[model samples]
Target chain A: MKIITTVKELKEYVKNIDKSIGFVPTMGALHQGHTKLIKQAREENEIVVVSIFLNPTQFLKGEDLDKYPKKDEADKKICQLSGVDVMFFPSVDEIYTDDEVSILAPCVRGFVLEGFSRPGHFNGVLTVVMKLLNIVNPTRAYFGKKDAQQLYLIKLMARQFFMSVQIVAVDTQRESDGLALSSRNVYLSKEERQEALKIPQSLHLCAKLVSKNIRDRDEIVQKMKEILNPLELSYVEILNRNFEVIKEVELGNSVVLVEAKVGSTRLLDNIWL
Target chain B: MKIITTVKELKEYVKNIDKSIGFVPTMGALHQGHTKLIKQAREENEIVVVSIFLNPTQFLKGEDLDKYPKKDEADKKICQLSGVDVMFFPSVDEIYTDDEVSILAPCVRGFVLEGFSRPGHFNGVLTVVMKLLNIVNPTRAYFGKKDAQQLYLIKLMARQFFMSVQIVAVDTQRESDGLALSSRNVYLSKEERQEALKIPQSLHLCAKLVSKNIRDRDEIVQKMKEILNPLELSYVEILNRNFEVIKEVELGNSVVLVEAKVGSTRLLDNIWL
Candidate 1:
């Protein structure tokens, strides 16, 4: 697999390859969730390009911008094993300059859920994703459903901007214990790791409730909150596919989302019905 | 020339054309200035696409958005005569939906000059330009040097977002009496039209001063203001290509810009050294 460290080099490399490319953008420290995205991209296109950029702008002033995990060597190996055609690992300087144009996520959908817990997070995500998408010029881009809000926003951006690439939303990958795989899980201690399982567990319970025709959003949220007892819950929201809150969950068009603090790290998980 | 009014139809039309597209985006009141941009685009690429979108976002509240000139029949004839292959004229609803993602211009370079005078102007310009660029998927895009700051910010957006299209800057077109050609010039009464010539005339004096090795920015600005006397002058400033105020004219890198109000209409003109 080819590894690129600069935007120009990556674009040049892409230009030489005449194929339908699939792109997967991530923040590095690859986990099972990231591999799922790459594997799907690999299966769908002649070339799969994955970008690992720990963007600084997405993190707030007091957030983990400086201390965010970086497992570069391991990330490269994972991409190589996952059949990635190119690994774009650009430095902050290479991808961004002093004062440049940026993409802002949808004001309502982007500012709620993940955006509310961490304001301006989706702006950074959308900005970096746009840069990666333009550089890769992919025919199809893969995004996991694990980041439900982000996936929705990206799809919205692609449609809103008239970008040509097809956005393929892959299903979220989970651990055997039902915990959603996240790079941040590495920051969890043994006890905290166990506590993180409560996140996905509550989401699963919400799904089970929906399956039983318990469609009331408030009831589902309350039940999930009870299951996530003693944890610092940020929010438990049940919204339609458009990210609009609904009184009753509409099957195949609804999602239950939760964000909570497990130890010092924030964990987010959601279930699409 | 084919005129498409919906985004879906335009995208379909673009997909079938297997040629490099050169695009010129405008607001529909075709003047010598706009024709110059369209004419250049026609010359450079296999297919030329011109979009006439009076993007409301670019106009601030109470900024004459409703009264912004629109001469559709004349513009269509001009495009046909200029050899444009496609004319994309999407409605506001067709181009935008409720609560959409937006493109934000850079904080520094985006908010200088015209940006400083009309805050959030570049943000609106960049956002719409980004949408149009994505929709057209042009190989080369044409922009007039008349709106120097707008051109610079668009170039910044393209680079920052890693868009592949080459941005070609066409020189400003002018009237016989040295007034920079603008659709807004139509709003000028017979008296206001004569008064508007002072804008371009001021830039001419600044250019002569620079040619004579009068490098001091303030001195040249002062001289231009003398010629623009009795007219309501917005600003007469010398800036580098990056739009930062410069102490001395760095030949080949300086721009003399003037913005003035002729009656109720605001007009801008610039000369690039």
Candidate 2:
């Protein structure tokens, strides 16, 4: 696999190839979730390009901007093993400059759920995604549904901007114990790791309740809060695919989302109905 | 020439072609300046696309959005005569949706001259430009140096975002009497049109003084203001190409800009050193 670190070189590398490109953008410290995304991209296109950038703008001040995990050697190995054609490992200077153009997320949709806790987080996420999309000019970009809101907003951006790239959402990768895989998972201590299981357990219960047709928004939320009790819960929302609040779950169109702190690390998990 | 009105149709139309495309985005009332831009695009590319969108977002409330002159039929004829391959004319609904993604201007550069009077104006210009560029996916996008600040910001955005499209700045077009061509010139009455001559005259005087090796920014600005006297002046700034205030004008790297109201119509003019 060819590794490119500068935008000019990567753009030059991709410019001449007239084949379908599938791109997977992620922060380093690749996990099973990232592996699934890359594997799916590999299977779908003639070229699969993976970008590992720990975007600083996405992290709010006092957040884990400094301590975010980095596993460069392991990530390169993983990309090679997964059949990635190109690995883009750009430094912050290569990707961003001072007083540059930025993107603002959708006002209403962006300010809810994950957005509420981290106010301008999606701005950073969408800005970096946009820059990467332009740089790669990939035919299809793969994003896991694990970051459901981010995926949705990205798809929205592609559609609204009339971008040629097709956005594909892969199913979330999970542990045997049902905990969603996340880079932040490494930050949890042994006890916090065990407590993190409650996050998915709560989602599993919500899924079970949903399967049993007890999908009333308030009732399901109440039960979810109960399952999530004794742990600090940020929010538990039951919304439609449009990210709008609904009275009851609409099968195949609802998403139940939850966020909580395990020790000092925050984890996100959700189920697409 | 084919005229595409919807983003879907336009994207589909441009998807498979294997030729260079040159794009010119404009709000209608296509005058000599737009014709010059389109003609340059036609000469430089295999396909030339001209988009006429009177973007409302760029216009502050109570601005000239409604009164901004529309010469659609004339503009179409000009594009056809200029050898344009496609004309994209989209309505507000086709271009924008509720609370969607947006682009914010760069902090310092975006807020100086044009952005100063119309705060958040570049945001709208960039949002639409970004959308149009993505829809057209041109090889080269053309902008007139007439809108110097806009051109600079667009170039900055393309560079900052690593956009593959090459931004080509065409020379500014002017009227016989030395006034910079603009659609807003239509709002000028016969008397006001004559008064507007002082704008270019001031710039001409500044250029002549600089040619005589009088390069002090403050002295030149003061002299230009004397010539622009008794006209409601907005601002007159002489600065380096990077938009920073410079004490002395560098022969090849300075720009003298002027903005003033001619009977309540705001007009802008500039000279690139």
Candidate 3:
């Protein structure tokens, strides 16, 4: 596998490949979730490109911009083992410059859910994703359903801007205990790791309720809240595919999302019905 | 020349043609200025595509969006005569949707000169241009130096996003009477038309002074102001290519810009050294 760091090199490397290309963009410190995305991309395309950038703009001022985990050596090994054709690890300076044009998230849809909890986060994500998409110019780009809101926003951007690449959303990967795999999982202590399971447990309960014909959104949320008792819950929202809150859950279109604090780290999990 | 009114048709048409594409985006009302851009695109690439979209987002609430000139029949004839391969004329609905992801201009460079007069104008321009560029996926894109700030911002967006298309800046086109050619000129009465000539006249006077080795920015602006007297002047400033106000003009990097209101219509013109 080729390891590239600069945008120019990556562009030159991908410019001549005539085969169907698939791209997977992520931050470093790869986990099972990232592996799932890469494996899916490998299965679907003749060439798979993975970008690992810990973008600073996505982190708020007091957020974990400085302390975010970076496992560069292990990530390279994982990509090599996962059949990645190229692994892009660009430095901040190589990808961005001072006083540049930025991409903004959708006004309404981008400002709710994850955007509400972390304002301006999707803006940074959209901006960086746009740059990566332009540089890669892949035939298809892969995104995991774990970041459901992000996947939706990216789909919106691609359609709005008329980008040519197809966005392929892979299913979310989970642990044996039903906890969604996240790079941030490394931040959890032994005790806090056990508490993080409650996040997915709450989402699972909501999914079970909806599957059993519990159509009322309020009732589903209330039941999930009860199961999430004693934990500092950020929000338990029942939203349609567009992230708008709905009164009744539409079987195939509904999503139940939850966020909570486990120790000092925040965990997010969602179930798309 | 084929004329396409829908995005889907345009994309399909362009996809079948296996040749290098050069694109020029405009807002109908073809004038000598627009022809210069289209003509250059035709000369440079195997296929040339022109789009006429009167973007509403670029116009402020009370701006001249509705009053903006539209000469569709004339524009179509001009495109055919200029040897354009494809002319895309998408309606407002075909080009825009309810909520969208937008492109914001660079902080400092995007908010000066014309951007200063119209606060969010560049944001709209950049957003639409981004959409058109993605839709066309051209080998090269052409813009007239008549809209100097807009050209600079587009170039910046292409580079900042690592977009692959090459941007070519065609020189400004003028009439026999020295008035800068603009579609908006149709809004000017005969009297207002005569008054518009002073804009380019003042800019020429500044160019003559700079040729005589008068390099001070303020002195040249003051001299141009003398010639623009009795007219409602918006601004007359000199800046470097980076759009920063310079104390002394560097011969190859200087740009002298002027904006003035001829009756109710505001006009802009610039000379790049």
Candidate 4:
């Protein structure tokens, strides 16, 4: 595996290659979830490129920008083993300059649920993702649905910008016990980890309710809150693929989402029916 | 020249073409200035594509968006004669959807000169240009130096976003009388047209002063303001290639810019030393 750092070298390298490239962009702390994305990219394309840059713009002032997990050495090893053709690990300075142009999320869709809890978060995510996408110039880029809102917004951006790359949405990789995989999962203490399971459990309960023909969004959410009981729940939303709230779950077209605070750590989980 | 009206068709058309493409994006009513850009693009690349999009976002509230010039039939003829391979003309609905991601111009640099006169103008220009660039996916894109700040901001955005296209800046096309060619020149009545001569004349005087080894920026600006007297002068300033205010004119690296209103018609002119 070739490890690339600078933007110049990556551009020259991508220009010379004559193959369909698959890309997976991640904030480095490569776990099974990220590897799932990389492995899929490896299997699909002639060359797979992975970028591991912990973008700082996505974090708000009091958020965990400082405390966000890092496992650079392990990440490099995993990318090598996963058959990554090129690994772009750019520095923060390489990705951002002093107060340059930026991307702004939509006024309505970009400010709901996750966006409401963390304003301007998607803007930063979008800004960095655009930079990475332009730098990589991949044939198809993969993004895990663990960040369903992010995936949706990114797909929206790609379409809105007329970008040529295909944005492939990968399923959310999860722990066997149902907790969705996240880089922030490490921030959870032993007891907090157990409390975090309610996030996924609530989604599972919502799914079961939907399967039982209980289509009412309010009732499903009410039952979900019971499973989420004492935890500080941010929101339990049932929205269509368009991210608009629907009165009834429309099976294959609906997404049930949950976000809850387990002590100081916030956990998110969703089920796409 | 083939006319493409939809984004999907344009994408497909660009995909099938294996040759290098040069692009020139315009808000119709093509004048000598636009043709010059297209003619240069024609000479540089194997394929040449031109877009006639009157991007509404670039105009501020109460600006000339509604009253903006348009000569669609004439523009098509000009492109056909200029050897354009393809011409994309998309409607407002086809290009924009309800509430999506947007691009923002830099805070400081974007708010000076033309941006200072019309706030948020560069943001709109940058956003539309980004979309068009992505859609065209050309090897090289062309812009005239008449809208100096616009060219600078667009180049800045392409670099900041890591876009692959090479931005080739073309020199400003001018009339025999020294007036810079602009589609908006249609707004200038006979009297206003003659008054507009002061804009280029001031720049000419500034250049002559600089050529005579006069390096003081304030002194040069003072002299230019005198020549631009009696008009509603918005600004007369000098800056380096990076758009930073320089005390002394850097012979090969300075730009002298002027913006003024003649009988309610806004005109812009600049000279690169």
Candidate 5:
């Protein structure tokens, strides 16, 4: 359980190792979701690396870049208990310079749904992910399905760039009550916590409708919006797996994505049928 | 030399070999300059791979993409003669799809000099280079110093992204008459060919001034401009090795770059001190 903080050290360390490495990249505040990713990485490879850097670029000007949670000791403990070989906990300055290369998301897929409200969000995610992937050079990288759009875009980037690393998508880890686990879940007050359940509850309802062969996109969205009533809803999109808008849901190929603001914290949850 | 036309095949081929590879990426119509890069790649590593891709993204909307020169058979012969182990020649469709990930250049370093005249040019160059580098995953990649800014940006990108590939800068290959070798020299007619001599001649004068201990940037640029007179000069500037404008040339670190057009064909030449 070695903790490395600089990109150079991580690169050198990863370079010297001869085993196949599995990588899990995350922002700090390790929780059940992150534990799930690390546990899976531990199972799959001779070496497992987990990077916990709070990326600043991914946050917009008004977003909570400063208030992002940090639990370094707990994260380190999690990685150690998960059998992780190395933990990359780089500083913001170490990861980004004043002037450096950046990655841009595709216009269509990147500018819809999550991207519409939070423009340039994926660009930052992609830029940091690329930096981490290049630094680690892992054999396989684990990404949770909780950030469904981010996962899809990462997989797209890996293929489009012909990257050698295999991107593996782990299922979304959720609470027993069906609320998808997120680090920001802590931002919720007692009442807001109960309110946040509407997000996952909406998705659960959409899944039930989808299971019942309710394939119409409009009907599904309308029903989910009812479940999300009075919440500060950003969007309820029914799109194919490719992120393209479809007239109707195609079972096993469609995704019902929801983004809502519970109190001041924004949460994203989706069901990939 | 074995030629690979698809990304999948090239990845598989490069993956099976367990030797250090040196890569040189080109836009075909190989001249003495490309020959120098490939030849250097040949000497440095156990395996040498050359990619001949005329990346369309690097060309601007009104640029001569259609008129860009291509001599595939001759280029192949040159690669074979130069002892290249693998030649990757991918079609536009094979390398790119309708939707894909792209790389963006840094604002200051990317938008000056050549970048100013041709906006968004470095974006295209950086994007394609990233793709090719990922696909090949070579130990060392070769670039010429003629396109000084491009070389700098690519090196910066590799560093900023923590790319595994080592970017090695080769000196500019020149003709006996001091003209920098370029594939676009074919676009020059007999008269325009001689007119193109002014570009290198201007750089030669700039270097001669620096050798005489005359370090004033204005004086050096003025002298070069005199030699480049009546040639439809685009720009004559002096800057530090880091692309910053310098009042006085730094004895150990400076570059004098020139970009001018002859009969609507752009030519670039520079000297590094």
Candidate 6:
């Protein structure tokens, strides 16, 4: 597996290849979730290119910008084991410059859920994603649904900008006990780890309620709030594919999302109905 | 020549072409200046794609977006005469959606000169340019130095975004009397047209002064201002390629720019030293 660092070198490498490329961009903790995305990319394309960069712009001033998890050696091994053709490891300077033009997230959709909790987060994600997409010039790029809003915003960006690459949304990977896998999962204490399970449990309860013909959004949300009782809840939203809130759940077209704080760590989980 | 009205059609046409594409994006009302850019693109690449989009975002609320020149049939004829391979003409609705992601101009550089006079103008120009560039996916794009800041900002955007297309800057096309050609020139009445001559004359005088070893920026600007006296001057400053104000004119690295209002129509002219 080739390990590329600079933008110029990676671009040159992509330019010479005649085959279709599949890209999976990550911040690199080499968790099971990342491996799942890499595996899907590897299966679908002639070449799989994975990127591991802890983009600074996505984090707010007080957020975990400095302490975001990093496991570079393990991440390299994971990509090699998952059959990634190239692992692009660009420095912050390679991706960003001083006082450059920036991308702004959508006013409404980009400010809800994760965007609300962390304002300007999508801007950083989008700016970096655009840079990476242009650099890799992949045929199709894979993004896990774990960062659901990020995936939606990326799709919106692709359509809005008329980018050629297909954005493929992968299913969210989860732990056996139903905690959705996240790089920040490491930040959870033993007690917090158990509390994190409520996130998925609330989402599952929403799914179960929907299956039982409970279609009203308020009732579903009310039941969900109860399931998420005692935790510092950020939001529990029921929205359509476009992120617009719907009064009633429409199966296959609805997404029920939940976000709550587990001790000092914030966790989010959702189910597409 | 194929005329594409939809983003989907343009993307489809570009996808089938195996040859290199050269693009020139315009807002219709094609004049000698636009033709010069298109001609350069046609000569330099296997295919030439020109877009006529009157992007609304670039215009401030009270600006000439409504009254701005539109010579659609004439523009089509000019492109046909100039051997353009594809002409993309998209509607406002087709180009923009509700509360979409946007491009913000550079904090400092984007707010000076043209950006200073027309705040958020480069942001609009860049947002549309980025969209069009992605849609056409050209090999090399062409822009006239007539709109010097626009060209510079675009080159900056291409580099900053890691866009692979080469940006070829064409020389400023001018009238016999050195009045820079512009679509807005049509708005100038007969007497105003004569007054516009001083805009370029001031730039030329700066060049002549620089040639005579008039290296002081203030001295050069002062001389140019005397020549531009009595006209509503927007700005008459000199700066280097990086848009930094240099005390002394550095030949081959400096640009002398002038923006003056000939009656109500604002005209911009610049000379690369």
Classified by CAPRI criteria, candidate 6 counts as high
Q: For model 6 chain A, give the 10-residue run with minimal summed lDDT.
A: A262-271
Write model 1 residue lDDT over B119-190, tens digit each, in one string. 888888988999998888889999999988899988888888899999999998988899888888889999
User: Each model's DockQ?
Assistant: 0.91, 0.89, 0.92, 0.88, 0.86, 0.86
- The lDDT values for all models are 0.89, 0.92, 0.90, 0.92, 0.91, 0.91
Model 5 agreement with the true structure over B2-41: per-residue lDDT tens digits: 9999999999998899999999999999998999999899
Candidate 5 chain A worst ten-residue window by lDDT: A92-101
Q: What lDDT is reached at residue A23 by model 3?
A: 96
Kept native contacts, fraction for each prediction: 0.99, 0.94, 0.96, 0.94, 0.87, 0.85
- lDDT (Cα, tens digit) per residue for candidate 1, span A1-273: 989899899889888888999998888989888998898888889998999999988888998778888899999999999989889888999888888788888778899888998888999989988888999899999988888998999999999998999999998888899888888888899999988888888988898898898999888899998899989988899899999989999988998888899889998888888
How far in Å is the alpha carbon of A118 misplaced in model 5? 1.2
Model 2: CA > 4 A from native: none
Could you give the DockQ of candidate 5?
0.86
Give every collision pair in model 4.
none
What does the interface RMSD come to for each candidate?
Answer: 0.8, 0.7, 0.7, 0.7, 0.8, 0.7
DockQ of 4: 0.88
lDDT tens digits by residue: candidate 6, B135-166: 89999999988888888888888999999999
Please write out the lDDT profile of model 6 over residues A1-273, one tens digit for every residue.
999999999999999989999999998897888888888888899999999999999999988878988899999998998899999999999999987888999999999899999999999999999989999999999998877889999999999998989999999999999999998899999988987888898999998888899999999999988988889998999999999989999988988888898887888788888
Chain A TM-score relative to the true structure, per candidate: 0.97, 0.99, 0.97, 0.99, 0.98, 0.99
| Docking band of candidate 1 | high
Off by more than 4 A, model 3: none
Off by over 4 Å in 4: none
What is every candidate's alpha-carbon RMSD to the true fold?
1.3, 1.2, 1.1, 1.3, 1.1, 1.2
